[model samples]
Target: MGAAFRARTPSLAQLFDEDMLGDDLEAWLNESFLLKRTFRTCAVIAGLIDQRHPGKEKTGRQVTVSADLIYDVLRMHEPDHILLEATRHDAATGLLDIGRLGSMLKRIKGHITHRRLDRISPLAVPVMLEIGRESVHGEAHDFLLTEAADELIIEAMGIGHTAGE
Candidate 1:
């Protein structure tokens, strides 16, 4: 959201400009948290997870590994696995009704109002912010932290922003 970047420093947003929703909805909502949530949901559905078990106190380790570890292992070794695909595909492409979703994307491609914003738009703030805040997900933790530290050194030597800062 441009409001998040209005002054180059994050200020709590106060105004609301309800934007039109379209096929690009997928782009905004697809993030690791949503995927992880979907995996946990699907894991429960697939009977791979038992999120609610009576008298079963959840441990910290269990909290950390609920569905993510299984999902990650499956993703690495069995990328074609249904649950793995569901983790990504469900959240990324299932935001709206399945029947009409495909047509909306095609319409977006050649729509009369198609254009790119010069600055980050308000609707894009969540997904963009999510990119940095996902250090705990997959290999992103190592890669993002290393990249940020490298940028810190580069910034010390006069360089560019870190992770789209």
Candidate 2:
């Protein structure tokens, strides 16, 4: 039975890595578009920790994130607000402040509806949906970054064209 199970499935660490990557990508997108803040990464990490190990904040249960994973995501995304030194951690501490996380979540939720309506481009919605799916289930981190850069270029060009006319 053990041999058969081993032959048919991925190891637990592999599965956990995939899950963590997915969550990290989701959190990246949420930080990029919705929250537009680097500190929101901490909020996202805290939320994931809470989901995995509930009641930590209230019960004083220790919730922690792998600093390496956080650094990798931040390096890739290059959020405007994160400082280089912030990712470093001592051997014994969690990266996020649990007390601040709840308030960040509340602020994000409160602003989302209005922000979504104001910010999302109608033409980009379909592509955004595809990007969302790719972000969640596929390795499309570069794709998302490229799309955002291209969009900014196109918008800038449009502005230049309008100004010339």
Candidate 3:
């Protein structure tokens, strides 16, 4: 018989050790919503394992969805790097859901059209025209977009607006 070899699996805490800021990482993972918590936790743990054991190849379980499909979804939902960065920072502080707001705004902006609305209601034409005009002015458009995003976030979260006030 050939020489016997033992295969050992490391515990999660061992894979993501304390020396590598495991406590802070765990806290961050725990703070995420239920929908994202498992995937984020696995990603963090896999990343840590890869960092610690660069020589060993780490393979994940087969996923039903293809990588291309996942990339397409990300491309659709996460269009702006600035918005993504803001969302990541806000996650730690529990400030706001900027990602969702940005996604909603993107979809709404895409659907805004004079021809489409003209068929539905002629009275709404002036409002669409005003929106089109505001969108052309850089600074005004940015301010309006931010306000709309904030309002969308607040309404979705069912939170009070103007918390300090």
TM-score of 2: 0.25
- lDDT per residue as tens, model 2, 3-119: 433564654333333234346644654434322233334545555333333553445555455443454576677744344233222101332343344455544542432122457
lDDT of 3 by residue, 15-119 (tens): 333344336544444333421323333334444212225675545663435333432354368745343343345454442344454455555553532232226
lDDT of 1 at 13: 23
Candidates in order: C-alpha RMSD to true structure:
11.8, 19.5, 27.6
| Candidate 1 weakest lDDT stretch, 10 residues | 11-20
How does residue 79 of candidate 2 score in lDDT? 49
Model 2, stretches more than 4 Å misplaced? Answer: 1-52, 58-139
Residue 96 in candidate 2, Cα distance off native in Å:
32
Q: Model 1 off-target regions past 4 Å?
A: 1-31, 53-56, 59-64, 96-165
Ranking by lDDT: 1, 2, 3
In terms of TM-score, the best-performing candidate is: 1
Superior by lDDT: candidate 2 or candidate 3:
2
Estimated TM-score for each candidate:
0.39, 0.25, 0.17
